[model samples]
Target: MATSRRVSRVAELIKREVSQMLLHDIKDDRVGAGMVSVTDVDVSGDLQHAKVFVSIYGTDEARAETMAGLKSATGYVRSELGQRVRLRRTPEIVFQEDRSIERGNRVISLINQLNQNRQIDDAVAIEEVDEFDDE
Candidate 1:
């Protein structure tokens, strides 16, 4: 079993190597069709497996295509990782779509909208209070 610190370091290295592969080494047309980024990586305690979270910006069709491309290139990516990072055994790579960023943006937008509405209500309440004071 690996310590948490070692596992985290491995995860970071994996993320970096995979990101570089996606940016320069990968030649799949489908992957190139959209903008893709490595968002995070989670590695097992035993360091036998790693889940790579990726965020892609594009239409639904393009996202689907990019995922397919990633899936098909998994073996290649794993091989590249083994070469880039030295370890007793290279962890298996699993690609996952990360939607946390999108969800966060949506939440922020809702919050902003609510704030604007509250400001409008506050203005109306102040006007009512002023009229009452005049009376």
Candidate 2:
């Protein structure tokens, strides 16, 4: 078992290395079809497994291809980590598609739409009050 600090450090390190791999090392054309970013990494307290959350920006087909490419490259990524990192044993890597960013954007758009509607309602109410005052 590893301390929480050590686990977090390892997770950060993994995230950085994975990002580097995506930028320059990964050669899969499918992965290149989308804009891939490592959103976060979750390391088990035991430090034996890691979940890598990634956000891919593209059309649905492109995202699907990118995910497939990532899944196939998992073994290579693990081997690279084992060689580059000084862990006693390399943690197993699992890639997960993160949709939180997309969801957050959708929520923000909805809020903005609601705010615009509220402003319009307020303006109409003010106009009605002015007419009532004149009568």
Candidate 3:
């Protein structure tokens, strides 16, 4: 059984290498104008399958294009991995769009909106209390 730390380390290495390859090696036109970030990687316990989580900064269309490009280039990526990493077997690669960044941004926006609304309400309430005191 692979230790959690070992799994995490391998995941990090894969993410780094894959990101570099996407930026430099892969020459796919479908990968549109945007920054691609490898958010996370999940390697199976047996180290035969790898799920790569990527975050693309752009519209949904751009994200889809990038994902398609990645999927199409999976074989090359795996082969590259086989050459770069000293592993018994190069794991099959799968690309997935990470929505955690979007979710986090939404949460932050909502929190800011709530805080602003609360401030406005508090100001109004304070004015009302002051008016009553004056009366």
Compute each candidate's TM-score over C-alphas: 0.96, 0.98, 0.95
Error of 3 at 53 (Å): 0.2
Can you tell me which runs of candidate 2 are displaced by over 4 Å?
A: none
- Write the number of the candidate with greater lDDT, choosing between 1 and 2: 2
Which is the better candidate, 1 or 3, if ranked by lDDT?
Answer: 1
The count of residue-pair clashes in candidate 3 stands at 0
Pairs that collide in candidate 1 are none
* Model 1: per-residue Cα lDDT over 13-132, one tens digit each: 999999999999999998987799999999999999999999999988999999999999999999999999999999999999998989999999999999999999999999999999
Off by over 4 Å in 1: none
The per-candidate count of clashes, in order, stands at: 0, 0, 0
lDDT (Cα atoms) of all candidates against the true structure: 0.96, 0.97, 0.89
lDDT of 2 by residue, 1-135 (tens): 899999999999999999999999999999999999999999999999999999999999999999999999999999999988999999999999999999999999999999999999999999999999999
Q: What is the Cα-based TM-score of model 3?
A: 0.95
Checking candidate 2 for backbone clashes, the offending pairs are none
Judge candidate 3 at residue 22 and give its lDDT: 78
- Point to the candidate with the largest TM-score: 2
Best by lDDT: 2
